[model samples]
Target: MTDMASAHLSHDPKWTRAHSIFSAPSEGADVALIGIPAHEVSLSATSAHQTPGAIRDALARYSTYSSAHDVDLRDFSLCDLGDVDSPDHESGEKKVATAVANVRANHKLLIALGGDNSITYSVAAGMWPDLSKIGLITLDAHHDLRDGVSNGSPVWRLIQAGLSGKNIVQIGISDFANSREYSQRAKDAGIHVVTRDVLRKRPMADVMAEALDIAGAGGREIYVDLDVDVCDRAVVPACPASVPGGISADELRQAAFLAGADARVRAIDITEIDATLDTPDQRTVRLAALLVLEGACGVASRKN
Candidate 1:
């Protein structure tokens, strides 16, 4: 009780390295982080648009050192490209596409923080001129093969836009999150589906190895779509559709690390988190921030 308030110290720049302070894209860097804070067509709430800013603030709490990957994030180059202005769905997708093209041209790796899962279509479409040369993997609870233009339909949209279903591999599809018709659509398109039940039976590393093999076949560049809804509800309170009994927080972070470690993984999208809906502690936003750094660790491990 001896003047505790007077003993408080400010956040030191040397000790607090926030993600927002990452260098600009014009300066050139190994990874380009773009924020697509557009949720015009999200199935859940509209405030997902606040995720990018919240995550940047949350990133200030964590150190850059990654003990698991044995990589210091301070050594890696990351350009924070800032957020895109997409007031509507069409404009959002178009803006994201243009930004992604610029990021792909300048950065070795592209990591997009999403307003929703719909950004996946824009990111993947923008990254590769020809879909045949690309492989897509989604770690999501839903198949996302719905009919309309919303968070629930990026996969269908990507397929319609020339992405070959054979090159897409979906993991962690939980029960009650998908429908029989979408399942048939995946099968019809030859999209590989690895159920959560199946995932539980095997180690994530093993499952990821097989997924990467399918998605990276014929030396294709991979784009990973990480929908936070694939995580357990407790970990991602901001993800409206996330259910119980899903992948653990550590497992999702490990997935991001593994995806980044592969040179074939050209880009990744971390989606479906609405900062406004997050708990008072901002756990969801913090996790998303860590995932971005974990992706950087993956890039560090990749061969030039």
Candidate 2:
């Protein structure tokens, strides 16, 4: 075998590129991953704070190339900015916005690994100084319209922060995972609700096309948030609120890729998984890693 093929040897630790394989953070790269490793301030719990690092570890076990997309991750330029440090949720919000603002300023794609869904408001606030010019799309099991500063209320928080409800589109909303009051609030706010049942009734590509069209309306930049809880409980063992029936793992990856490939999508985030609660096989973390890769693949394809 040639050196290149031989180098694929199973025992070759040198060829193993962990998640850290990406180039180090720089002002030059057009795509970057930023970690927010604290959920205490957002969820009122600290369990998911370790997820960012765990995702990187799981990523090391996989190849960077995607035969399906015909794209090799190493061919793309991306940076890992490590993690943001904040003592409280209030500060965490500011920190996240600042990080996202930095990415926007550099004209780069921001892939944020979140402490929880709360990161959405902060990211949107940072990416669009004018909320009126922004569109929000969330693939989540819940409306996230709760009336508090916790993980369940980011959508409501963003609306209060000046985001137009008409520009928000929520997908993968599952049964029994939300309250009637919150559902009514979503409707009253004019938020477009695309339930898990709706997805079941249509092709994923068609649903995503419609989602992108709605989210990109008026030429506004889109911020897509992927709450891991949107996936089935079997696929997201680490997401405490995840239910039994939801989108499949492959479907979620496709959604992320579609969002990332859209020119209007300036930022994306994956949230709500608690690494400490993950299965022994680390299936959840591995899936999260693949989601990141799929997003990167979309970015790479766009550049090509």
The digit string of per-residue lDDT tens for model 2 on 1-304 reads 1244234446554454536457777886867888877577554464777788778666776777778889877776888888888613787778777777768766557888866777787777877788888889999999999887888888998898888899899999999988899999999999999999999998777888898888789998899999999999999999988999989999999988888788788888989989989988888888898888888888877854
Candidate No. with top lDDT: 1
Candidate 1 has an lDDT of 0.84
Cα RMSD for candidates in order? 3.8, 4.3
* lDDT (CA) per prediction: 0.84, 0.82
TM-score of each: 0.93, 0.92
Residue 53, model 2: Cα distance from true site in angstroms: 0.7
- Clashes found in each candidate (C-alpha, N, C closer than 3 A): 0, 0
Report RMSD for candidate 2.
4.3
